[model samples]
Target: MSSNPASTPPPPNRTSGDRDATQPQETAEREINPERDHRCESRRGGTVIIEGGTVVTVDDSGTEFGEGHVVVEGDRIVAVGPGSAPAQQGPVRRIDASGCLVTPGLINTHHHLYQWATRGYAADATLFGWLTELYPVWAGIDEEITHAAASAGLARMALSGCTTAADHHYVFPRGGGDVFGAVVAAAERIGVRLHAVRGSMDRGRSHGGLPPDSVVEDLDAALAGTQEAIDRFHDPNPGAQVRVAVGPCSPFSVSTDLMRQAAELARRNGVRLHTHLAETTDEEEQCRAEYGRTPVEYADDLGWLGPDVWLAHTIHLSEEGIARLGETGTGAAHCPTSNGRLGAGIAPVRPLLDAGAPVGLGVDGVASNEAGGLGEEMHQALLTARARYGPEALSVRDALRLATRGGARCLGRDDELGSLEHGKLADIAVWRLGGIDHTGIADPVAALVLGRLPKLERLLRGGSVVVDDGRLMPVSEAELTHELDRASARIRTREVSA
Candidate 1:
């Protein structure tokens, strides 16, 4: 969208089947300096050893080490075991993690990063009312606003232990000036993996949808835009920093043709599909009234349920819907705080998990949830499950799994991410548990989930420090705050003028 090379998407190296062929070439070894600023350092081929912490692997075996060590070589985990790492050959930067808890970096399965500029609006509105109040304001967003909002949102996510985030941005107003590219650039600037869903909405209020007509694209344009996004930015390589997915907003705001065609396009390009599904009772009622079928049933008819598809919210599903999702191996992204904030009913999380569906946690959008932190989602998810179902509905470990391995499955990245196993990408989080909030907790994992969200001692994405000593390394938070403030003010002014 932009002629600037820095903003342009990288050409895809290989097809999905040839992921192994795109392995990063080794870089020349350099002296390891622990005290140097990590933001300015070259990350490739660097070795980092983290010892003297409780390592929760979240692997298939559910491995946990009371006092463990993790060795990172380049961008992959070389070894993970109890106690200190063995002898290393190169200059390695060792982090003494005596009072920390090491775990797989949290993965956010669903979000609308652009909404960061539109928070604190429609604070007490229902799902439909909120859309009614905010769609016009969202229509005022341009590339600058979107970029600022996405940067601030991703910065919050990184500081809170999220390494990979899926951002579903569907609102593309006329002359928005490359808002989607802005999101991708923000992810790059923030140094986190992004599943950028090029979302579209073809059903406007005129077509019995919730959003305004100004924000909805025609069916042809929507499909063309999605295709262009895939051609421009979709990366199929292993350990990809950015991947494109097809999303057509929600059923209530999308035409049936767009829904069917988006699914087909995703499959044809070997990419994934994402969308808001059964998020509220209003959505269910609308689907039933329009198609004489429940939301889940309607989706199945459109071929929207599969392993490559992950739906957001999923709060209004019935038993049969849950069974269908599991039978089809579909994934669900549970946004507990957002649901509670909007008075959307609690999702049937335990039932969905028991039915064999892959369940992950989502921060949704800050406009709805306000906090916009991935780590807090784990805590909210655990509390919501126990409050809705029973005390045994979910455990602290289960909550961690939902944020890590389960999220990896939802994104179809289980083989490459979501765990601290050998050969896996070194996306890890170290939480400082020595603080007052976590000092008395007997179990580090419990303190992480059941207690307060611990401060991140360090967050590494692909062996690069994203956060160190509870501070984001790549960019200044104050700069992001100022950018966000200006962006929000501009959007507000435009909305008022319009």
Candidate 2:
């Protein structure tokens, strides 16, 4: 959209970071001026324009260096491409992104937001062992900790250049909290697009499953909660801000009956499905003994193989399993760092991608990864795939696509958030091309993937700034530390009994 520059506000690029940690909610919203919040404008006011950036629209035409900007008359991208993109010489706020590489905000396919508080505890544990150890810790969650953890995770992800994400929260301790719609509130406050999966586990140790019985849900309650979460937060509009997915934690933690029913319920409501599958060799053996088939075949038998399903960590898939994934349109959420740390095998990413299955990168959970940075997962996805095969087997661009479009598709949000194209949400991440890692690099996108992590200069959700100048512009560091410190002290004390 064109602007006269005189009436509109100049770039609010000033570093509001020290305010991020303490005023987490307000800062995350970037509501410095309440009367003029862009989101409010979308709901009640008018339009805003993002002008002049090197737009990297990851469309079928590949990357395009459209020198012009984008126009968001409301919440949608009204125009793109230099001269052809719409220009509204109207009253608007102009963000001049001259020397930045603008791509769709990174779509995090899978995440565990509350687990941010439980990272170091599960460092040396495997998939089953890891859950056995931290399941109790998660069992302690309350509304306070859940809110803190969700805000903290979203802030961290936003700072790391993620604009939209899917969080899979499965722990439901007796007195834990009302996970019901807390994730939705957090996303609204943070101003990022979110898909919060109502993750569940029904069979516990008493029933021969992995999790403690205390953390497992009654099968009926589990199914009811899944439907409730969808009814309350699963938006299906074009530019939806929130959605829900039905996730039955894993093969070992849930009963096969719950798995089959969860699939049926999700289909009934038209929501997507997610679950952890084939993450490690131990998992494979466990499933074989209990379910009588490999993870892929087992899920297929349960009607969980389709475009609506995305399984985490297909690290042990065989050749036939990979082909089945491709043919069925099922997706995989690859978590390289979590796999390596847990001693789980490297996922057969090369074979999966070659077969044309949808693949997206995930950070898994903070407890397993110990790091939640957005770009970090993309880098790991690239490295792990190449390590398993040759360089030609996977390129940096392939990994990047997994983080963006593939993630959107996995979360069933591909129509909106994945790419920087017209009629999509105005969520974009802009990184500089002049960092130490790219002082003399030639190609911009290559400078990002091959070189050191490009500095996250700015991150926008729906054309609103959340991170500016390598830090969260709204929250303060001191506040985040205080919340983290308080949480840490409690966690340390509880771990003794937990």
Which candidate wins on TM-score? 1
What's the distance in Å from true for residue 386, model 2? 1.1
**Per-residue C-alpha lDDT of model 2 across residues 1-498, encoded as one tens digit per residue:** 011122222122112221112211111222224335333332322455444446667665554553555666566677766522343454555444554566788987888987767768866777778888888777777666676667777877887788888889888878767854666777776678888889999988899887778889999999998988998888887777788899998888888889999999999999899999888888789878877899899999999899999988898998999999999888999888888888998998878877778888888788888778777887787787778787665665666677888887777777787787878887878776664666565455655667677767667777666766666655655676577667666766776786
Top-scoring candidate (lDDT): 1
lDDT of each structure?
0.88, 0.74
Inter-residue clash pairs, candidate 1: none
For model 2, the run of ten residues with the poorest summed lDDT = 18-27
- Stretches > 4 Å off in candidate 1: 1-36, 40-42
Model 2 C-alpha RMSD vs. true structure (Å) is 8.0
Reference-based lDDT, residue 137, model 1: 97
